[model samples]
Target: MEPADAVTPVDPVARIEAGPEGPQIGVFFDLDGTLVDGFTATAHAGDRIRRRQARIGEVTGVIEAAMRYRLGRVNFAKLLERAAGYLRGESLADLDAVGERLFQERVQSRMYPVMHEIVLAHQRRGHTVVMSSSALTIHAEPVAKFLEIDHVLCNQFEVDAEGRLTGRIARPVIWGKRKAAAVQEFCGRHGIALQTSYFYADGNEDIALMSLVGHPRPVNPRRELAAMAAARGWPVLRVENPGKGNHGGLRGVLK
Candidate 1:
């Protein structure tokens, strides 16, 4: 006798409500370039700073440091520290206020629709979604809240008792290998298994965390990451550039 076919319901609400039975998996996403377009918040903030004609010297220093950092000539942490010096004595609340403006005006519009759908898909499967980045709390927090992500793993700057910036990072800057360590530490604390975890990133610096995860998906990857993904037979996801005539389209390269 033939067995009866099982039917699966197609209700989105039900699917999201129905949590998985087995151990939960971790889904880590790199913020800049991966989920959203590159450093939109920072760019907007810089523009605002420039318009105010304040801290011109610090701004110049940061620009130079950023150039060197991009060329792989300076320590990323040192660069970040030098950048933080720009915010020295600035009000934390004021920073967040500007960050909100930037998020709305520049960052929100650039977030990839495809990536948002992917995040929703993982959430429906009862997996933890984490927004991991080197972006500071002021920038990353609002974005995380908007996305309804379960957790945020990112760098944070030190604040004085009165809630002013101290020009120092609260934790070891979360970038490159430091990001991998943060993921590992989180997994250990939360009882999530690394072998079953998934990571999505676009930068070469994220290669450490990518290698550690069971599933590594590259989104709009740069040259180094593209090469690595291709050689490893990993799937590469390219979300369409909305402003560049490709709207809501997706392409897979080196799949």
Candidate 2:
């Protein structure tokens, strides 16, 4: 007689909600430096920066300015416009393809397993998972798909009919308050309550989003964010070098 089928197919969404009795939680994660160790897309963009093939530093400077603006020190619109200007005149297909290739080859491999497990654990607990990044949507979307994230909040580029890049953002750039805006819109559309959500990020630029969530945690945070998180009494997680047995709170679940 044939043996009874014993394998069970687990539902990721259901698994993500298996935590202690409470309202369903939504986990929003920042892509660079939070989920992953570094900025892969930015590093790839650096190639164009170094070659002067593009005004990458100018764009980056604007990004930095935008971060500062989020901290209430500058004009956000001006910084965004300046950043968009740097990408003018590029072929969208070429830039996107190059970025995708570089990201898959050099960046994807460096993903920390502990971080991956944390994402999965949240998923298994039935939490709605989102990947929010300052990178262009072309890059962030693929990474989101690869990680099976439920949603993505990222920047979009305008492309002409000929597939050439107009170097203008198709929508408001997703960073800082823009990120918080995107999250708010998403929650509104999905009927999700922001008061019960969670957000994880590592940089000073993400403070707006961190403040928006009910449960905010800083994971592998930068020095500035670390200080802020401590002052706010938020949890700080360190997952680097999991093999050496330093996974922090993730150890129990991982084992």
Candidate 3:
């Protein structure tokens, strides 16, 4: 496959505006490294560390799991579970509140302007925009609310009776192909045609959903995804500025 030279970032909103728009058109966007610049989970993890919530052993475990997953040794679920373990016993409410504050302070300005324009174009056309990532509700919901995206398909934490994190992800980790399936199911439920929908992402894990959508828009794609996009002639959108580079994606840091 050729390199993504032919797929450099271009303003694609004009082409999008030419397409049919309605609630039946589902437009999916990956959270980190696609819609936003840096990883939101990075901020979340930093907050945990700043407050002395993350233990040394847990942080080491998360980094190790992330490395293993990157090397294709451990599964994404393992990486996510390992990271999620650090949040045990934390109040979900507190986490949510901090997530909002962190977004305003750390994540909001990092959003890529190009992606924001694309999202608004989709909204103007009345498309059903969704936030789809393995990032937790804390990391994803704020962005969804800010962007006015009504639907979200992402991993979530399970809590005990008192609304404390159980250190376990709720069933069905929404990563890779599972994330793809979640989108498909949502489209089915809403009568949105997948063949006409669009998916924008930066990670190789997003390839599953990318393959299924009519438009596989790769935003700042990592090498593997770049290669795949080039081979398939998918339109790749790159942000050349510093800090906009794909930082191993939300999967690399999210709990």
Candidate 4:
């Protein structure tokens, strides 16, 4: 199947706003595990596969291959091609509708309180808040709307002439170093300074993203990332569980 045409560019004013100090502060957040807790949107896709509601395993396998390729165990282009082949005939409207329902039902309730607070704080400070995730942008959009973030950087599925999915991505999948590239592109286009930006992430795989920002914080970090944070002296924060006063240096990190 032929790949779908690129999505019409969203207007800049619709996605970003000029701050009083002219983009002095921009906050970048990684969605899974950083903002939301326990579950990820990908898991919802897996559930759909199990229920036979979607042929998502084909895409999931491609994602795994891409992960292996990132770790230098496989060929990158081949993996992307293999993954893109999965959506060659899906109805775009139906996939989007199902994805929205899955996001609301399975992913919305898992958000971390501390992460929500941090996002709100950035908004209050007049900073441009953006979310980046490996999940499809369709899946991320509802959450982004709910959080009132300024923009989202995520993978996009290509659609055919009839508005059916071509099972291909319009852009390279947003992951690992590619995520950093997306951020740079966004910053360049928006005239935001990278060195004044803040990034929050939970895994070492996101180290490239962390390194790009002037201020990087590891939030509810995985074991390996937490260790790396300690070695690098980057601030570490834990999402406060219910009934637990904020702890683990989150208060200071936000300040």
- Top TM-score model: 3
Query: RMSD to native for every prediction?
Result: 6.5, 9.3, 5.4, 10.6
lDDT of 3: 0.82
TM-score of each: 0.87, 0.73, 0.89, 0.75
Clashing pairs in 2: 15-124, 15-125, 15-126, 16-123, 16-124, 16-125, 16-126, 16-127, 17-125, 17-126
Count of clashes, each model:
0, 10, 0, 1
> What TM-score number comes out for model 3?
0.89
Ranking by lDDT: 3, 1, 4, 2
Off by over 4 Å in 4: 1-22, 54-84, 240-255
Q: For residues 171-250, could you state the per-residue lDDT of candidate 2 as single tens digits?
A: 77787888899989888887667777878788887888888787676777787787777667665656564334554224
Error of 3 at 236 (Å): 1.0
Ranking by TM-score: 3, 1, 4, 2
Off by more than 4 A, model 1: 1-23
| Of candidates 4 and 3, the better by TM-score | 3
| Candidate 1 global Cα RMSD | 6.5
| Model 3 lDDT tens row, 1-255 | 112345233457777788897899899999988877767898987877898878889777877887888789998787777777778898999989999999998888788766787899999999999999989999999999998998989899989999999999998999988999999899989999988888989998898889998877888789999888768877767664435475322211100
Per-candidate Cα lDDT values, in order, are 0.77, 0.68, 0.82, 0.69
**Candidate 1, residue 92: lDDT:** 92
What would the per-residue lDDT of candidate 1 be over residues 102-193, giving only the tens digit for each residue? 78877887787767877787776778789989888888887888889969999888999999999988878899999999999999988998
- The lowest-lDDT stretch of 10 consecutive residues in candidate 3 is 246-255
Please state the error at residue 95 of candidate 1 in Å: 1.2
TM-score of 4: 0.75
Judging by lDDT against the true structure, name the best candidate: 3
